[model samples]
Target: MLRAATREAVALTGHLLRYPSGIQPEQITDPGAAPPPATEGEGTGAPPVLLLHGFSDNRSTFVALRRSLLDNGWPHVHCVNHSLLTWDVHEAAELLGEHVDRVRRTTGHDRVDLVGHSLGGLIGRCFVQRLGGDAFVRTLVTLGTPHAGTYAAAALPPHPLARQMVPGSDLLGELAGPTGGGCATRFVNIWSEHDLFVLPAHHARLEHPDLAVTNVRVRGVGHLMLPVDATIAAWIRDELGAQPTLFGAAAERAGERAGPGRPDAAGAA
Candidate 1:
């Protein structure tokens, strides 16, 4: 376990060093170099997917996964860069709301699917749960997020957002209230068994009574690699492609009984 953690840490460091600022400005603005748009006959019923990176990370972190989705017939995939230094998760969620609205307006799609990593997952959930984002989000997929907060966060330097991520924080309390109730969006929480940053990795799972939630267990990947992991990317792509339906209260109960680390019956692409 120690060796695996060390190896993952080194790889994650390399990923961060390679794309320090996340997505490059040129990649966003280069019209001629953009990923191919969906053809008229393809992706006719699928909603556009919006990718959100973890705290202190940029849109570039999703480059590989985004490319994989596009190649597999996902019509539109967009990434957002949030303020790296923002200290409030709610504030970030508000910003994300604006971005979601813009994507809906620009694409003429009534709803979009969200894929958020780490802190980005919390931000997206805040929008869906508190900022009226459920109306516009068909599905919410989170990777390596501290849904229940984590002790690991307590070790970080004091910051409002970091404080909020500590177990039993007020912000987490508010966000945890009856999530998924009366919301039309489906929630998929994906976490890695080997994620060190999330402390007890199961803290990343969502257990809400009123929401349709699926807790997906992934092995081998670490916190930073969740977004880049090929198996995870394929699972997310499949989830996004499926039609959105409320999982209902009973189904959620059944899932809980099944416990965690259940193999992804959907398999990989």
Candidate 2:
């Protein structure tokens, strides 16, 4: 127990030091700032990616993972800096809708992908499932998000959003309704076994029967480290680049079939 606590503490400290204000302009690539020229073999023509940080965190929270995506061929990566003072997840989701629209308009892409961490993930789901954002989103990837709400939040102050995150909260109950049905957007839920904030860890999984969901279990990483972990970043990059599959088993098969040095019968001339 002490070791796990020590690890989480170190990871949290690193996260705070890396993005004290949650908005580090130098580390992230802003699509609005001078758009990068599309390069062959790069993320050209791919869907634009919009990153959302966890609660009380800034766009800087995605610094490491964004760098990894860019380094791996993802060209258009953008981050949204939501205010910590915001009290409601629905309001945050509304702001996310605006940002998604802006990204689509500026990039000239019909759709974009969303990658959210922790509280940001919940906000993203609210946008996609509740705010009609599924129309504009191709994929929704979340890391350490509590889709089912978390008991751990019960210990926090009863802030509006905080209250919404506690297990059995009204917000979660409403969100758990018949949403995500017939939505075109795909969902990828990733969580760490050692995540301290997402009590029971399984709360991170999205269990909607109609929504196409992929639950990824990651071990040996803490909740705070999900965005910074190199392995998780690589997995996310690959997932973004590849076509979406039905579930984890199909995704694995798809990966094997598309592995390097393999001939593509579908693309053969």
Candidate 3:
């Protein structure tokens, strides 16, 4: 079953990549120069982790991370659904906060650990910075998130959503900075030297006081491959401090590493 789930997730990601959202620049309305205040941490309950995907991607990009977390004893994993039409990064942050609240209400958890990949990471960072998600966010992990503007993003059509991703775009500039950037949650940035999207590699670093930012450079990985990499998953699991019992027959293979297929993390079929 775990194998099947993993396969399904990979397939889903492929489907998402086939249809990139076409956001027009005319439709993008910046939330303005003043970003929303950072969210305050609350004692709602133990925060569950939320997974977000990048542009031209879907929630399935987190399949490996989700499986690793579950294997390490984290069962509460959810995702964000940012509409394809929305080009405003600030608005995306707000919508993400609403989903975090929804997860809290459903699971009775107070805070959430946010895991985002690529553009999704930027969106999550904005949530903690502009929206009030920091109040309910315990940790923020980003895989291949371009803290600075990427060459590929600059080359994209001048869509509002595309412009927001540029290094100095109003939204990107707000979230991309020396750690803390006025955020109130733990932050982790994971990147690959061979990434096709964010080239030169240095664009993925985040340094701030309030944030525990770690710029991990991995070899033999690409932008799309980083999020699902087993080594990367294990690194995130260790950072989050979760450890699950690898039990049953499936556990044998699951122990191969934090990459995928852990029985304890998935339900028995």
lDDT of 1 at 77: 82
* C-alpha lDDT score of every prediction, in listed order: 0.75, 0.75, 0.64
Better of 1 and 3 by lDDT: 1
- Model 3, 122-190: lDDT tens per residue? 888888876767788878988888888676887876778777777677776666444434556777677
Give one clash count per candidate, in the order shown. 1, 1, 11
Note the residue pairs that clash in candidate 1: 23-60
Off by over 4 Å in 1: 2-7, 21-45, 179-181, 243-253, 256-269
Instruction: Give the C-alpha miss distance for residue 218 in model 3, angstroms.
Output: 1.3
Please give, for residues 1-269, the per-residue lDDT of candidate 1 as tens digits.
Answer: 56446657876886767686565532232232323333222355467788988766788788888898888876668888776567799998998887777666655667888999988899998999988899989899998999999899888877787888888998889887875459888898887777899978888888777778888666666787778766677667767877332334565465532212334333311
- In terms of TM-score, which candidate is stronger, 1 or 3? 1
lDDT score for candidate 3 against the true structure: 0.64
Worst 10 residues of 1 by lDDT: 25-34
Candidate 1 — what's its lDDT? 0.75
